[model samples]
Structures are given as C-alpha cells and as structure tokens.
Target: MSEPREITYAQAVREALRQAMQRDPQVFLLGEDIGVYGGAFGVTDGLLDEFGSERVRDTPLSEAVIAGTAIGAAVTGMRPVAEIQFMDFITLAMEQLVLQAAKMRYMFGGKARVPMVLRTPAGSGTGAAAQHSESLEAWFVHVPGLKVVMPSTPYDAKGLLLAAIADDNPVIFIEHKLLYKTKGFVPEEYYTLPLATSEIKRKGKDLTLIATSVLVARALEAATQLAQEGIEIEIIDPRTLKPLDTAAMIQSVCKTGKALVVHEAPMTGGFGGEIVAQLCASEAFDFLDAPIRRLAGLDVPIPYNRELEKRAVPQVADIVREARALVRGEY
Candidate 1:
C-alpha cells in the first residue's frame, strides 16, 4: 500500500547483520578483514565501530579454522555469522563445513544445532579470475544438512540473511560479487523470510524464466525486452537452493507450459540440470509445449580477461535470445 524504501544490496545485508547482532547478544560476526577493512567489498564497513571487535571479530585467513570455530560457538549457544570471503575458497574448509557443521546434528541424533551462517561472495563479473569467481552453491545443495541461500534482490537478501542467522541449522548465504552495488527496495522493519520459499519476480503465461543470484536480474531484464516482442516471460527466483521450492516451480511450469532455467554455473553438473530433472520427474512434464530449456555458463575456468569472463556467464542478451525461442515453441 506504500512505496518501499530503496537501499543498496550491500546496505541491506549490513543492516540485517547489524540488527541481528543488536537484538541478540549471542549473535556475533567473524570474518577476515571484515572489521577494519569493512569486508573485502565493504559490506561490513561500519559494523566493527558499532559492535566492537569482540562481537564483530576479524579472524585469520584460514577458512577451515573460521568455519570450525564458528560451528563450535554455534553449538555452544552463539549465533555466529562467518564470512568465507570467496566461494571459491570453500574448498579450503570442506571438512568443517561438509562433515562437521553439516552432519553434526544428524550424527548426534538431532541433539546438536549448528546455528551458524557462512556468508561469502560468489560468482563472476568482477574479473576476479578462477580462484575468486566460482558459483559453488550446487556443491553444498547436495549435502542434506546444510541450508543453501542465494538472494537475488536487496529485499530478499536482508530478510533471508536474518532468517539464516536465527536458524538452529547451518546456512550457506551466497552473495554474488557483482551484485553488491545493485539497488532495490528493503523495508526498515526487521522480518525473517521463510527458509526455502520461491518468489515470482514477474508473472507471464507464455514462458517461465527461472534464475538465481545475478542471473535473476539478467532474467528480469530479458523479460522486459521480451515483452517488447509480444512475448511475456515469467521470472522465478528460488531464494534458497538446498530446500528448493519445487511446488512453485511446478506450478509455474504448469501454468506457462514452458520452462527456461538459467544460471551462472558451468553446464556440466550445474544446478540447472537438477531443476530440469526435478521438472521431468514431476507431473509438470505433461504441460510442456516444448522441452524444458537450460541456459548456463560455459564449461571453462573463469578468465582474468574482463570481456572473456563476461561472455562466460549467462548475460542479458543470452537470456533474451533464449527466452524468445522458448516462448515461440521453437525449443
């Protein structure tokens, strides 16, 4: 009923962290250079000054150590928000994240709760090269215990991050490196969005454009352009990956009778394949006008060359072109 408050994606995230810390003394933040450096991308710029080092801690460069410590604190009744710096570096802490944090509750017969949130900058578009620009959400999505969250808009980012921190389970919050500057509306009031709900960003009947992270923005742009050509594209953003909202996905596919899943991850074993399989596995397959389509990143290491890296991931032009064919029943 009223205009939403506009805010940058980074600020929305910062506000979520700040508010969570303020509300719960058990909630603290730990990350490398997050305090003094305000995070590598300045998302935690003023947190250190506000919450002090005890709560807004700056940890060593070891991701395993960071994750292990956070998990321990969480198990001991602390709501710890750990920053991974880069999603590509998650490999360095696979043991703590996958084995310990993810499996602790199940191994202990549901007696333990790893109320920790691992926030990391993920995906390419900033020319950070292979070691810095990786979309690794699919890796954790396969693990049953971990909750994987990837927010595509500022409003959802704030609410979801809050929900992640308040959870009694471990959550991997993947923030796109290229989406920090993107601005959107965020309510000043605090609220925790549901864990795995998918939101229909834009509605249409001809085709469904499903995307995640920055690709959601690209998909929205492509939808707008497709409208000019008399093709309406419905855009869906799965706010959480592990506990994916398959019901909404199936509903959208059933309504539109056509689906196009897009992502920044490489084609081979990318999560897009999982979505396609889920659709075909469901009754929604009967409603398709054509085969479900997938548009994903090229199967190659991210290049340091700006233009090459830009071309590697799904772009607006790619979504636009791909959505057109799906709506035309050409695919």
Candidate 2:
C-alpha cells in the first residue's frame, strides 16, 4: 500500500480518468471545452497535452452530439467517457442516454454493451442559478438501465469513478460543484471501490442519517454538533444511488430505529423518497420507533441569489435541528 496524500476532489477525478485511459487504449474522452480549456470546473485539466487530442477530445457546444457520439462509440467497442458541462444540460441528451445507451444491451439480447460514463457537476453553492445548479440524480435513477453514483470524498471520488468507467453500462457520475475543491487523503496507487456498496461513515445508536454528495459533509458536521448535546447520529452515505446498498441502510435503521434522508435534490421527487419507500417496504419498517423523516431541498427551482439558494437546500444547522427533533420524537 502506498502512503496517502491529500488532494482535491477534482484532482482525484482527474487521476482516475488518467489511470483508466492509460490502462485501456480503448478509453477516450470527449466534451465541450475539455481539451485546452480544461473543462468547466478544471477536472479534466492538462489531459489534452498528456494524451493528445485523439484521446482527450474537445467537441462543439452540443451535449446531444457528445452523448450520442459516446453511445455510438461504446456500442462499437470503444469505451468513451463523455462529460456534460453541467447536469442541467443533460436534458438535451436525454434521448441518447435514456432511449439508446440505457437499452442497448437488453435490446440486443446482451449482444451489445454501452460501456460509457457521463460525468457532470451538480448541486448549488456557487450561485450558478437554477439551471446550472440542480441535483438531478433522481431523474437517472428513475430510468431502469443507468447506474447513479455520487462520491463525497476525494478517496471515494477516485475509486468509484474507476469502477464506473470499467462497468459495461451507462454510469451517471455526479460530482458536487462545492466538493470539487474540497481536499481529502487519496492513495497514490490505482484503486476501485464497489459501485453498489453504501458506507456507514459514522456509527451511532440513536438515529440514522442517510446523506448524498455535499449533504454528507453537512451531515457529518451536524453529527459533531449533536454529539455535544448527547444526540448520536449514524451517518450512511449511499455512495452509489442506483444499485443502492439497501442492506446496509436497513441494518442501520433497524439498530437506530429512526432514519432521516438528506440530499440537495428537492423533497417531492428526490432519491430520498425511494430510500424511504424501500425502508418502509422492508422489515426495517417494523424496527422504527418513529417516522423516517426526509430533510431535502425545497420543492422549487434553485434560486440564483446566494442566500435564497442556501435556503433552498438542507444545511448543517437544518440537519442538527432535524436530527434533534427526530430523536426526541418531536417531528
């Protein structure tokens, strides 16, 4: 094992892409401004010079074409990693992703595979307005064929991304805009983490906090604050949204007897709803001492004003307040 070094989340993603592309000659990248411009958030920076334009490709400002091209390449035996500048633009490429890439393998009776990755930055905090700052993972999860992954830390960001690239299916890899520059320790050697595994980040006996992406960090912060007041929260990060590790979540809920799902996506149709529904259907529902509450983004378009945007999503204080109430049976 190599010594771990601190690196930003964006750096970890770049390292994963570099390692994957180097290890597989068939793997190539295509996206708008990803070549010399180095990506919208600089996650793909410097790759064009290292691998040249052939592998590190730059396309015109057309997400539909970028996605369609990747799907075609994947079906033809190429592992193309495409980037949608922001998740908001994915709507333009929905046909290619939902209709084609997601159904190719089953449609062709396992004779064809779409081993492609669609990486995009999501979530608010940079005040990029409603269009650019939406947490739309639930949209992909609703589709039967796509694998949804949201990595909160640099370590998981690197490992899970490598796994997504290797999988012979379309993977919707979401990176929170605020998490990109956040630093964490990452091993120098290449590694892969299971895409279906959910990790219990912090163990507690009182309540369970299931969080995704940027909310994971906020939940952990809230956990620290609540610890001082005697409220113990077990934090579970479903690193992979689809193919979710329901067993891990169920076990945590069974032990704690209360659960609260937190995410930046709106409450009405967020991924948290699916988690709650699964828990309700499972035997974990019997173990609950109180209702499983969800602390999520407001059911409205994300606001462009910094203060209003912050209000739209769950915050550290919101988690602390909600956890306190849930544990006390006040919610």
Candidate 3:
C-alpha cells in the first residue's frame, strides 16, 4: 500500500462529487453560482467544465426551488445533489425538505425513494454573521426521514459524502466553513463510510469528549493540551447527527466515567442536549464519576464582530477548561 494523499476538505468533497457523477449517470448537481462561478466557496470549481451545464447546473437564487426541484428529480429515478448557498437559507425550503421529501417514502408505503443530497456550509467562522452563519443540524435531526451528516475531516467528508449521494433518502450534508481549508490524508480511490456511525478520533481513559463538526478539531487540540498534564481524554465525533452513534458515546463514557459534550450551535436546543439525555438514560449513567457537562455557543445569534464571534462559540480553551473541571469532579 502507499501513503494516503493530503487534500483540503473542499477538494475532497469535489472529488467525491466528481467520482459519484462519473460512476452513475443519474448523478447531477444543482445550485446557485455553482457553474461558471464555481461556488460560494469554490467547492464546485471546474466541475462545470467537466460535467457541463446539463449536469452541473446553475439554478436561481431560490432555495425553495432548488430543494423542490431536487425532490422532484429524486422521485423520478434521478440522483440529484442540490447545494444551498448557506445552511441558514435552508429555512426557505423547510416545507419541501421536512414535509415532502422526508415523508414521501413513508406516505407512499415505501414506493418512493428520495435519494437526494442537500449540501450546505454551516457554522459561525469567516464572520458571515448571524443570518449566514448558524449550526442548524439539530433542526433537521428532529425530522424523521432526513439523514444529517457533519464530517469533521477531509477523509470523512469525501467518504461520507459518497455514501450520502448513494443513500436512498434525503441527506442533509453540512460542511463547516472552517473545515474547508483544513487538510487531511484521504485516499484517492473511491470509498464510502456508513452513515450514523461514530468515529473515535482519539482514545483515552480519563474522560470522553463527544463533539460534532468544527468542534471536533477543537476537542482534539484540547486533548493534546490536557495530555501534557497527564489527563487523557477520548474524543468521539458523531459524524452523522440524525441517526447518532449513541452506542459508541455510551461505551466511551462507561469506560472513562466522565463525559463532555461540545458543539458550535447555541446551547438552548443544540444536539448536545440530545447526547446528554441519551447518556443519562443509558446504563452509562451508573458509571458516571461526575455530572456530564456541555460547552456550546452562546444562546444569542452569532455575532459578526471577529472577537465577539470567537467568544460566542467554544474554543480550544473552553474545551480544556470544561474537560479539566469534569475530570476533577468540580461539577
């Protein structure tokens, strides 16, 4: 075997899209400014030249139309991958996604298949402000038929995205803007990661740090800092949010006897709450040496100010502080 090649997260995603399209003629892309303009973040650059306008289409600035059209295509035996310029704009297409695409299969008694992938950039980095920057994965997780996936690294991003495109259901694939430039070793060949599976990024015995999206990178940094003081923290990334990998999280907490949940979303109704609830209800509750803690973004909308935005979400320091307190039984 050879060493894996390193590539930016955005490039990995593009590679996955190109491979999937080449593998299946049914695969196509639809989004705003995704054609000649590449994309809002250049993720789809050069795709138009390769796949041409028919497949790599540029749609109007209407998220609802993009989503509704994708749903229509999916139901008609076409695998369409639609891109919402920003995850926040997904609010404009909630009806098409939540009600129609999500319920079509069940309502029709399994006769319909909505094999569509809705890719959007999420999180508060890059100073996109409140409206353009929001971690809204939790909202989709509440819906039954949608599969939510947030890949933290380039490797997972490519593999999981390929899997999302092939899945016979609506998949809300969220890519954090901050992770786009981050590079990781990814295989050049085609591969797929199973949805709803949790990955243990690092193994430790002191505490379990379950993080999602961009926070996964922060948690890993915090782990390295904590290790200098002899504190080992296991880090788990629940890549697929909707069908959460609760078993992996529970087992980690059971071993370490301490757990800390972290995310970039506002703490109010963030997915972290769901993870804490699962831990409390599971058998791991008995193994807890201290209260499970959650460190998340402020409840207010994401601030546009650089300093304020940095303060709004959890950083490496926040994770370190919370992990220290949890391991020390400070509650």
CA lDDT, every prediction? 0.92, 0.95, 0.95
Query: 1-331, model 3: which lDDT tens digit per residue?
Result: 3678999999999999999999999999999999999999999999999999999999998999999999999999999999999999999999999999999999999999999999999998788899999899999999999999999999999999999999999999999999999999999998999997999999999999999999999999999999999999999999999788899999999999999999999999999999999999999999998988999999989988999999999999989999998998886
In candidate 2 the C-alpha lDDT for residue 131 amounts to 91
lDDT of 1 by residue, 139-246 (tens): 999998999999999999999999999989999999997789999988888888998899999999899878999999999888888889989988889999978998
TM-score versus the correct structure, for each prediction: 0.98, 0.99, 0.99
Worst 10 residues of 2 by lDDT: 101-110
Give the root-mean-square deviation of each candidate in angstroms: 1.2, 0.7, 0.8
**246-266: candidate 2 lDDT, tens digit per residue:** 998999999999999999999
Error of 2 at 18 (Å): 0.6
Model 3, global lDDT: 0.95
CA deviation > 4 Å runs, candidate 1 = 1-3
Choose the strongest candidate by lDDT. Answer: 3
- The better candidate by TM-score, 1 or 3, is 3
